[model samples]
Target: MTFEFTADDQLYQLAIVLVAGIIGGELVSRVHLPKVTGWICTGILLRGLEPYHASFSGLTTSAVSSFAPYMSFVLGYIAFTVGAALHFASLRNSGKRLGFLLVGEALVTPIVVMAVMYFIGGWLKPDEMTLRTSLILAAIGIAAAPGTTVLVVQETRARGILTRTLVAAVALIDMVAVGVFVFATAYLTGLGDASADWHEHWQHALVSVAIEFGAAFLVGTAAALIALGLTRTIVGPAFLGPTMVAVILGAWGAAVGFGYSGILACTFAGIMVSNIRHDTVRATGAYLHSIGGVLFAAFYTFAGMKLDFSLVLEAAALVGLYFLSRFVGKYVGAFAAMSLADVPTRVRNTLGLALLPHGGVAVGLILLVQENVHLQDIADTVTTVGLAALAINQLLGPSGTRFALTQAGEKGKDLPRLLDFLDEQHISVDVTGKNKEEVVRCLAAQLYATASRPSLPQEEFIQRVFEREQAASTCLSQGLMVPHAILDEGEAMTGILGISSEGLDLPTPDGRPVHAVLLLATPDTDRKRHLEVLAAFARTITRDLNLREQLYHARSAAHAYDVLHAEESEEFNYFIEDALTRAGAFSENKT
Candidate 1:
């Protein structure tokens, strides 16, 4: 039977796409590959079957192409969300380590890829070998897939220095890649014209690109302010999602109309809102993340539908070369850079492996290259090589990232239970203190006395705790306070729990007097773990009213420890199991 498509049929087409994408994501997730790989494979399968089955045609090329505008919207949204990682506080905390790594990887990746590609091209296809072609390919190689990296990090809930650095690096890499591509494109355009004034053309192209970037920045900044303003008046996902969508789409449209970068514009807007209105950005991000899985499935499926197997097969050699070169470049460059920058050994070893995924931005760059008049002669070859490399990398990159995280000891590890660090000797049910400083001093003395090897004198430790409290009140709302510090000579994390029956005058966000105080001290190296422990305490005590009451009203230290341990056991198990499943270990065991 012949299939007659109509505008109304688009809904049915969308349903099929969603279902197929979901199935594909689920299938691959079970087998230990990234869900994105499966989504793309589903699209490829549907497209390949189209010739044999006429009905399949509707769900493949034509149907997917119809959703291009929607796909672009999703891409812009993903880019914007990724930009949230560029928060100033995070950068300030990370400091020079992150900056050095970003510069090193960004420079090394393009240089290595270009050199390898140039040599390979000269040997295999001398006609296609040109400095301009090599530079364009290198520029494309500079883009690491932030979307994939972010998704995988979220999936595993990986937290550590390496993970933080990876996120920051990915964000910086894209910006660098855009800048490189702009300059490289201008240079290529000048090269294409031998008789024309090269310097004049270069100057003109650079000015035009700069104008496009400026327009994008202005549009993005305006959209961010508007979105922040809307958050004050609008509440809930029902209003919030659509409102933000309108803002993002408007920015995207403006970028397109002005011949600017929509991805850059959306990303800048995301960064602005995230830093300026953190709560609003977080709420919106949570909503986006909830719906993003389906959108991503659709996007990758569409990407797969466009895959030309014939082109992949013909360009197999070039694709293999490009893939290996890029892989080696990222690994060596990241490792060397981190080492030279005095990053921890564990981080330097595993970070490069996690930086392997390449999608979205790279594909976007290739499309940009394809549309340029000066680059049309090499567009087909470039696209073919890119698709093949992407296909391999998308399938393999996430697994490599998972392995790196697992090896770094960040994956499959939950925050330590309160009882894990607190023992009978470390708990004080009756604490006599008149103020916050006195309570903190009591806890610090208890912690220092209990430490296996007290790194600092008791008075010195108390002074440090007071200094930390002055910097920021650890007292959270709902009668809880976590006084924490890191000492230079400290080797292991130590905790002492103190409860005041009458409560102390501790400043808290909710202005509630603090009854329970957990003092944490760790070595300077375990900052990530220190934060995790603090978060675990806050998350557990704040949510469970009964548990908090039990601890607060406990007559003895033993009773309080029991209550805390019981609550921690349940929460820790759930997170640990989820982390294992995400790392693919649980599935492997079942198999």
Candidate 2:
């Protein structure tokens, strides 16, 4: 039957997918879960409509089929963006340990999986399946999904030896597994033919995978070289961005046209663009961020549409076997590898856990294998197992990473942060007089007292600030003092004003003294952050002539800050009008 989708039907289908996908993704993200799982699960659940399956069966017809490939293209860009984030030297240090672990897992996972599958196949339907069936099933078990794993890690903002090592290890290992898969798949297709040389199988698989990667690499390399040359010819880092994205998509196209590995191509291309005698990082980062939204949206929604509940209903057995193989391969390998490398105990423990994410690499590989001729059964098995494993990984990966980080003492500890009600704030009034040192000291004391801060035991806080003032005048040309200190306080940003009716003789980074001092204080927040706040405030002060004069003529702290707020409010969005050429990105908020 011809399935013609009316505009309303198309809109309905899209709305369902998008809304369900977003809600699921947001719900998962709220609970610190991997977004990929949320998206995929949303798709699976939508496909899980036991009653509506028949109603929407025609949704998968020709018109809708086009959407899937379009989604795939977007997914390809997302994949390229991920590749672009990878630093070339990320795997440099852990090469030996990672290699040993990856090789051992790749080889052992297949063997262990084959053994289990053979037994399970015997138990389930002894006369139905053969040894080749077990091998094929086992090969799928050997593959890992690098996409969701990467997602899980990225969500945690995970850093440390273990996280970095896991990322690099999985990336390299997945690439090798593709080659392993190629040979295993070829052998399965050969199917016990006595004349079919297994060696020839390896040669063919390796050649096919390698050629795909090589052509893609060549195209990407040339594209990056061209971009670099162009960036040199034109002396701004701006155009390099658009050029880099074009290179990524162009490489993606070459990979498809030549039947090459797009991941390898894009990965190589990103590295070349970043390293090829040009500073393309900012440009590349912007390009990646710009497309992140649409790619993620499409990826999640598409994933939801592909979820087949029937396969997942049969997921119980597949999930068990897939993880069993991974456990036998990954943990055992990790423990052994770390021990061999003499890694410290705490890190070694975390490494075992950190190495468990199977993301897009595994999923994409499963799809590729699924498309392979003669090994269609194997591919089906891989996809089923992969989707199942991905579901589980998405649920567990982030939480596990969080656990490891907390255990390693790398968790962000939010300290005693006084949430200064900045929506509308005013510092207390200051009343004191001049002697330079005496007036500043009295001002500090009044602030500490009024704010209920513990008095400095030796007045060293005040003295130290004064000594810093000695290095340079804290006074600006118009008489504003920004005396800041690196105090041993908790992480917080507070504004306190010091009143000196006669003013203090304090030096500025500029070369003047004797006037108004805005004692900027921070606890544990980094110096750069404090500087950012100062710079932001500085821009405000420097922008308005009347506001600066009012601040200069300030009698009390509360009154001064009122004018400060008025000034900040008036010019808070200077960049939209003043900083740029009011383009689309800038004008999005422009008046």
Q: Which candidate is the best by TM-score?
A: 1
Best by lDDT: 1
TM-score of each: 0.71, 0.61
Worst 10 residues of 1 by lDDT: 412-421
Off by over 4 Å in 1: 1-8, 192-209, 233-238, 413-591
Residue 533 error, candidate 1, Å? 7.4
- Per-residue lDDT, model 1, residue 412, is 38
